[model samples]
Target: MADPVAAVAALDEPNRRKLYDLVARATCPISKDEAAAAVDLPRTTAAFHLDKLVEMGLLTVVHERRTGRSGPGAGRPAKLYRRSDEQIAVSLPDRRYEAASHLVTDALVEAEQTGEPARVILNRRAYEWGADLAGQAAEADASRGPASNRVTEALARFGFEPLAEGGSILLRNCPFHSLAHRHTELVCGMNLCLISGLLDGIEASGVTAHLDPSPGHCCVRISQAPSSRSPSVSR
Candidate 1:
């Protein structure tokens, strides 16, 4: 996978960014000479920046003969540049809306084929995915300390930004922020199921996941189970 941060940083230079835009907008790959002329830069300068973009995985290079000739007389193939197929995204707080979108799409398709409710399918799939993630983490490292710590580590790995506060785990960032805002009930319910599955897969005890929405935070919160909560005694 291409590092999105590096890809974005590669465009920070003015000439490089311009060259990238020019090549991306073109219908076909562009040669170094064409790119230099279009950007009003020297050929060497343009080539340097273009190659840098290629190094950063923002652009891909191809060598093809501009002149339609197959014999030895045909000069060395021209170095052509074009936008890469790699998808680069950088989101603050590390949202995973793309994953959520895929899950929803799969749920809709499965519901149509199996004649099941979309909501039910989505929740079940999300739960299974969460459990799979936990299982993978456990397999990666068996000795991950206590259940709470393991759960927090898994949540953080998935970009939930879990924060341990008092006896509850408050998710500081929602991996599906925009979608949750638009489809509050559906997305939140899916998220709850996912976390619940993670907890179950890891065999977490005395902790229950629930919907506890607040401004600027995930809709779901993990807190002490009702039976595990201790009553306050009068002094």
Candidate 2:
């Protein structure tokens, strides 16, 4: 996993950020020579910055014979750089909009097929998805295999950013922040059901999910016992 802080720090340099922009905007991989010319920098400077980006996991490199010439004089292969698939997010505290996207999209599809209310389908599917994800994680980590471990990892992988807080795992980020802000009732409801399903899927007898909304924190929090307190999301 790429360190979020380090990834953001790498782009703090002006020239490095410029070079990254060039490569990212390009239709295809760019060479050091091309990048330098585009940014009005020397070949060596561009190469240095490009390599730095690669090291930071912001870009990927490949050796390409771009000339399309075949002979002893074909010359050395050119080094090319392109944007990496790695996602770099530096949300203050942390947030997970992508996870929300996955849940909402899947719910939409499921609703279309079943001819059911979107919210209801979202509730059911979110739990099923969490359970399915836990199963996959368990299979992938057969060695240290405990359902809780797998569940924790799966949540982290989805950018939940779970952190220990007072005998509870406080979710530090809500992947669906914008949606939650606009449709607090609907989104938080989906979130609660989704996490509840996650706990069920993992067979986590030791922990339970609770709806605990706080400013700048995830709406759902995981605690050792299910709380009688139910958080109301405005519909």
Candidate 3:
């Protein structure tokens, strides 16, 4: 998937954004001339912006002969632009609602098949998924570091935004913020289990995952395990 930030930034230019809106609102693919006329831009300038949008994955391109005649007198196929099927979303602090939705959907399907509680399946699957994320991070970079630093680095990439204060790693952002607001108990429980599984998979025995909820932050926090009391900090 393309970076959401870059994809969104591509539309920051006025002419590019206007051409995008024009093409997106059209029922069928539109040629550069049609888009330029609709948006009151020169055909060449509109074509440049349209192609840039295509490169950014905001639009897709196809060539088609607009004229009915094809064999003898038909001109070359006109390049048409349309909105791509890619879903682009940018959230402050980087929320992962889509990931939460997929987990919930999977749990529902499995629960229906096995006659197990959806919540149970959700918590288990979330933990497994979290562990998988940590495992992938470990595989990507094999350097050894403090447990807290490893946890912070792993969670940061997943949009948890972990911040170290004194001896504990406080998560400043919850990836499933919106879902957690509507279903606090269920989502928070799943979050706790997920972080716990991450700690387990990463072999971060020096730290423990806790359900310490506060406003504007993730419910999961990592603290130094009592037996391994050592001051480790990271941002």
Candidate 4:
């Protein structure tokens, strides 16, 4: 019911990182020992941190068992910790995305002024970051679902944190977006088309990328388009 982000904030830094570290790494949910192992904290410390998380409603005890020595006589199993279905989230800083977007968009704007070919500029970026893309390709080879997973992973490689949501994904970090005041149309549209192309290239066809200012999110919107579509990539 309360803001989860606020609750996480209420914690100390190491503790806060511990919590995010849990949600971030959870594959099929986790138990107490699992969470503890995630942060490399002592069992007691992990239990303490987990108790705080439980109190804040971020976690709930699923089941309990007893654990003790078994030399003369063994006890029951030990209780394990798991995350609650409930979740509360915090907003990412828009200024960061906007600033990064500003840089790339500025380059694009400048390219236009100097009459540099557009495709050449875009390809130049992709090539310049070839190693980064190669690393992401290797990561993508490990997952399933639409190309979005790989897209998110690649973006992560590029330093943006993306969260998976319904059909669409949330970009917690934006490496672009700052030139809004000056290069509004070009920069925004460029990012949109760029993401759309990325999705398309990943075989996630029919995915159209859009920037939603209301919730401050950018994501792919899969929908049928007119017969003709431009091949130019962006963002």
RMSD of each: 6.5, 5.0, 5.6, 13.1
Instruction: Give the Å error, residue 4, model 3.
Output: 2.1
| Residue lDDT tens for model 4, 31-123 | 667777777877777777777777777666654334435555565555555666676655455234433444466567768888876545654
Task: Give the lDDT of residue 65 in candidate 4.
Answer: 36
What lDDT would each prediction earn against the true structure?
A: 0.86, 0.78, 0.83, 0.55
The positional error of residue 33 in candidate 3, measured at the CA in angstroms, is 3.1
Candidate 3: stretches off by over 4 Å? 64-78, 135-149, 200-205, 226-235
TM-scores of the candidates are: 0.76, 0.70, 0.78, 0.37
Output the number of the lDDT-best candidate. 1
- Model 3, 160-199: lDDT tens per residue? 8889899888999998888888998889888887787777
Task: Give the poorly placed runs of model 4, Cα more than 4 Å off.
Answer: 1-135, 139-148, 219-235
- The number of clashing residue pairs in model 2 is 2
For candidate 2, the C-alpha RMSD (Å) to the true structure equals: 5.0
Candidate with more favorable, higher TM-score: 1 or 2: 1
Q: Score candidate 1 by lDDT.
A: 0.86
